[model samples]
Target: MIEQTKCNAILQKEAESFRNTSRRTFIKRLAGGTAVIAAAPYISCGKAGDSFEALKESAGALSTGNIGDEAFWREVKKQFIIDKKLIVMNAANLSPSPVPVMEILFELTRDVDRDASSQNRSKFSTLRQQTREAVAAYIGADPEEVAIVRNTSEGNNMVINGLSLNKGDEVVIWDQNHPTLNVAWDVRAERYGFTVKKVGTPLKPQTAEDLVEPFRDAITNRTKVLAFSDISNITGVRLPENELCAMARDAGIITVIDGAQSIGAMNLNMHDIGCDFYTCSSHKWMMGPREAGILYVKKEHITDLYPSIVGVGWEGAIGSGTARKFETLGQQANERIAAFGKTVEFLDAIGKDRIEARILSIAAALRDGISKRVPGVEFYNPQNREMSGGIVKFASPEIDLSDAGSTLYETYGIVCSVHGGNFPGIRLSTHIYNTMEEIEKATEAAAGLV
Candidate 1:
């Protein structure tokens, strides 16, 4: 304890000294060449001083550096086990977990497997609470409002099934919602005889109002729910969530936000957004283990929604009525939940603002590269920062986007999403792990195809 306190004191002094350092120099130095992982980036809870030192060492790779510096992100990329031979740009679908998260996941899983008993596994209950608290803090919500679940789909469905609806009650949803949020409502509407109205926005939204006005105009007296995605995987349009949520609240309607693509890639404050319900999959932008998710319900409305799946943990006690009641699904992968806490811890160590800036920087670089190199490149994603994020979608009449994904992978070992239909294009999602070098190479590969 003495040694840990001394280390923290030293770290605090160092941090104070570095406060005046230029932001550019900070990013440049931090983005220095990849260094060996000496420790995970966590210093609290009385961990050994060496652990703190190790975290500092690991963080050195991302030390004072600019987001445009390939050397800096290249170091950040080293923390993952992604293949060096491939240029993976599909953060919209999945991301690789960092070394610390994977390590704890394996270690705890092995410990559980070695002795699966009430006596040995009792700590997981506390760990689960810690997980919820970590996720809650990350999203700026109360721990009681956060429910650890399986994925975005499950969370969305929980809100869909938990809410009370009746015949002729209309739910307004954005047309660009993921199938889970879009089709799941239809399934329930079919059985319950409610109306599902999907409001459409222009493919290339010119402004935030272009995205917001459609949903704002869609609401009516019968609109009981307004469900939408903060960032759409299909069109890559980032909705004006705060405006939309406030609109719903004013209309006395519930708001359910599918944050599948927004949570980890951007800085989010659930309370500030004031949505009634929010759901996120940790596997995508969070780079946590699969089958892990988070569900946030406003404290006021927790009692109004029913638990979609109730089992061993379900209780009639007042204490049980919290968001925990919503997570009463049978036995869960406790190891993943434990690892998820580490995932949140890792992200916290890096700082969400830093992560968001890095992602946007790379996406901007990609857009600029494609426009300059690829002929007739037409972007589907809104160029405005308010209506777009790390996901960039574009197409060229000279190239066939339907087969662009396979071709990029086969020819250049680059992985990206290719969307077909009315909006046929290639989608490249940049995260902290991606590099300027990879983005440049992808642009070159795309130019050749054109």
Candidate 2:
């Protein structure tokens, strides 16, 4: 208890210092002083200190310019450790963590390695709660409503396997959901004898209603759950999640949002969306640590949903009436959890709305550049800003998408992904780290493939 209190006090002091001091001054102080982790005897100020300084400098620089200005975003780009030559436009799949997040991860990992004794590791419990609180606040959720899970896949499965779906109950999901959310439902349904129905939206949705009505129409009397991605990774279609969740609520159906594409890419409020459960990956848009994710179960539904993993903490979690029950998975990456909190801090420091706008601006530029350069290019994602996030999916009939994706990376240093299955196209998902010039180069390289 004493150690935990000391850790909390140190964390509180650091947080206050971070807020009160100027960014440059804070960076200097942070680099020169012991970090919050240093509250534990086994931990020390090391590479994480240097990385924190770089992050603060970059963040301090970004605060000076207009959101739309390229120079402003260049400062944001400096926060990342991505190579200068490579232009990575696939935040939907994975993202490179900023220097600070990586440094914390490295530092904490070494802390654990230095002393695996229970005495040395006891502080993680306090740190875990801190991360939960930070993550919940960032997403407009309660600390008790949030669980730090592995990734979106684990969270989705927890909701999938944990929900009380009996035979004959139906689950309605969007066709564009990631395979984990889509196929996993089918897999569970096959064993449990529940129905899994997929709703397909228009290829080019003209309005928000165009995206919402399909799922609205798909739900029936037997439907017990509505599952869909906030933004489709395949087509880059941003679903009207609030509308869909509201509709499901009116019908007394559980709403599960797979937020792999939308979480850190936009300003999100889980309370406003009114989902019974929400899941997201930090490795994608949040750019935190790999294998870290969030699961939010509404307070009322906490006891109803069973935990998928029952390990060390299960005894207390089972009746806790909190989302902690879901995170009873044994032996988590404690270092990543600490860094996840740092990720939320980083994103919160840079206003969520600002980040979203920067991403949308880059996406809009890419879409426009591609349309102008490649004649007869077919865009799978909606053109309207309201109907999409940062993901821009398009295909030119003249060019082979597989070859175009390779050529973009191999020749132009523009990294993108190709999808050949149902959604056959080239996908370019940009983020704050990307620049308009890189988008232009990608546009030209893609056009050259045609």
Candidate 3:
């Protein structure tokens, strides 16, 4: 491991270089940044104390290698609390919380249990605000623009229920949106008498425009909202969110993005994407605790959407002034909410650009190996890195994917999902914690099943 003072010196020099560059150029620096490990030594004083210090020490030893190095990722994998024997690839559904996050979660929960009084748990209110700030900074959003909620489903429903849509109003959405984002609109339509339109996305898209043009063609004078996922949970098809959001703005239509799959899987700048509302769950890719999520409502639209559930601490005439107006849903799991800060710190320490690069590299390796090793396999995911994130879906007509998934798990202890959708196939999600060796293991396991 690099010595603490020497590591600090190297990082101070890199910090000067980064401070002089634009965000776009800094992303290149961040992707190629050697300072993640160089700077890790300085975080030895992180809130979790020695446990986080040990993680920093491990990271410091990994500064010399590039982001894709196995030696580097093996150190990262150690930070997660998981069974090394099992090959788990279902990051799109859920992931194990990192050690620091898990540690703090347990500590706080025990503290809450020890003293269940109102004054004893009051500090969490400040911690919750700190968590909101951390999350907002991570996503390039303002602190006031974010609301801490239960999950993506709650955030999506908040928009679906709160928006002022009347009879004959139209909502345009993609067919591949998750059930919460796709069908929830129809349920609202049934009550409010609005028209819901589903745009058919191309099964095999050649370009980003191909994904955007369908929504462009589907918009009409009656269309009041344009809602879709930044990346589909079904086929792993990534939409051109910036262009689509721009199109919606030009048409004076409200835009909401179901960001369930994109948040921690990529280097996302919510402000750059410029949608009216966006929602995501921390458990999926962010690897935070379950039943905790974030809702982003633009500054101008805060008043336009009402709070779906009004509970205690909701002041009527005097609004909460910011996104907190939407967050007054009564008591919460203070322990899990407090631990969100630790999860953000963990990801930020690795650097978001580095995480995105590592995930894409592993997913690409898995795709190449599977296509080469397995015969008669058909890929439903977009191979272009620009049009995909970490999710990879594929199928073989000769093999029943459900049976293959079961056999692979039962025989090889490999864990992945056989998804049911328009594209019925296997979905493999690769995250930063995953190694190239695991990718090869998963690919070889599928080949053996075939």
Q: CA RMSD for every model?
A: 9.7, 7.6, 9.3
lDDT by residue (40-130, candidate 3, tens digit) is: 4233322222344555555555553346468767777766756667888888899888766775665466556756778667767777887
Best by lDDT: 2
TM-score of each: 0.86, 0.88, 0.87
Report the C-alpha lDDT of model 2 over 282-332, residue by residue, as the tens digit. 999999899999999999999888778889978787777788888888887
Q: Give the worst 10-residue stretch by lDDT in candidate 3.
A: 30-39
In model 2, residue pairs whose N, Cα or C atoms come closer than 3 Å (at least 3 residues apart or on different chains), thus clashing, are: none
lDDT of 2: 0.82
Superposed Cα deviation of residue 237, candidate 3 (Å): 0.6
Better of 1 and 3 by TM-score: 3
Candidate 1 lDDT tens digits, 281-389: 9999999988999999999989888878878757652367689887778888887887788788778777788788888888988999999998899998877888889
Error of 2 at 19 (Å): 28
Q: Model 3 compared with the native: what TM-score? A: 0.87
Best TM-score goes to which candidate?
2
